[model samples]
Target: MTDRRLASVGTAAESRLPSRYLTPMDLVAMFRLPSVETVYQWRRKRTGPRAFRVGRHLRFDPVDVRAWVDAQRKEVAV
Candidate 1:
């Protein structure tokens, strides 16, 4: 039925939607950094996870941020 097709299409679209975007302040709280300025400094040094500009503001993809955090992990032996 056409209704069934439409429902499937909507589900597919939702699956393709991007993860939540994070603002600088969100990143600060998520990482417990000193301030948002630290994020900007990381951006300048190209040492932080990649970010994209949305209009005039900077945005980070949650997936990318999580991957970056995972990459920073170090294993410690007891």
Candidate 2:
């Protein structure tokens, strides 16, 4: 199969999404958070980037992550 077809095989909606999906640990490092628990807490409170489950793991879309950070910046400016 072509590389394009391989890419589409993973995510149903985001066919262009690369194979790398961010884990909660990635978010912790990105935000300099104390722990992965903070990421989970944000998920619980609905105050962070949108996430979805992959089997038993949580995954995030990079596009959504960037948009979320941008939204936060706009919020702070207001």
Tens digits of per-residue lDDT, candidate 1, 1-78, equal: 999999999778555535689898988887799999999999999878789999999999877876676566632221
Q: Quick one: best lDDT, which candidate?
A: 2
Superposed model 1: Cα runs more than 4 Å off = 1-19, 74-78
Best by TM-score: 2
- Global Cα lDDT for candidate 1: 0.82
- Candidate 1 TM-score to native: 0.68
Q: Residues 23-42, candidate 2, lDDT per residue (tens digit)?
A: 99988887899999999999
What TM-score does each of the candidates earn? 0.68, 0.74
The lDDT of each candidate is 0.82, 0.86
Where does candidate 2 have its weakest 10-residue lDDT segment?
10-19
Candidate 1 — which pairs collide?
none
How many clashing pairs per prediction, in order? 0, 0
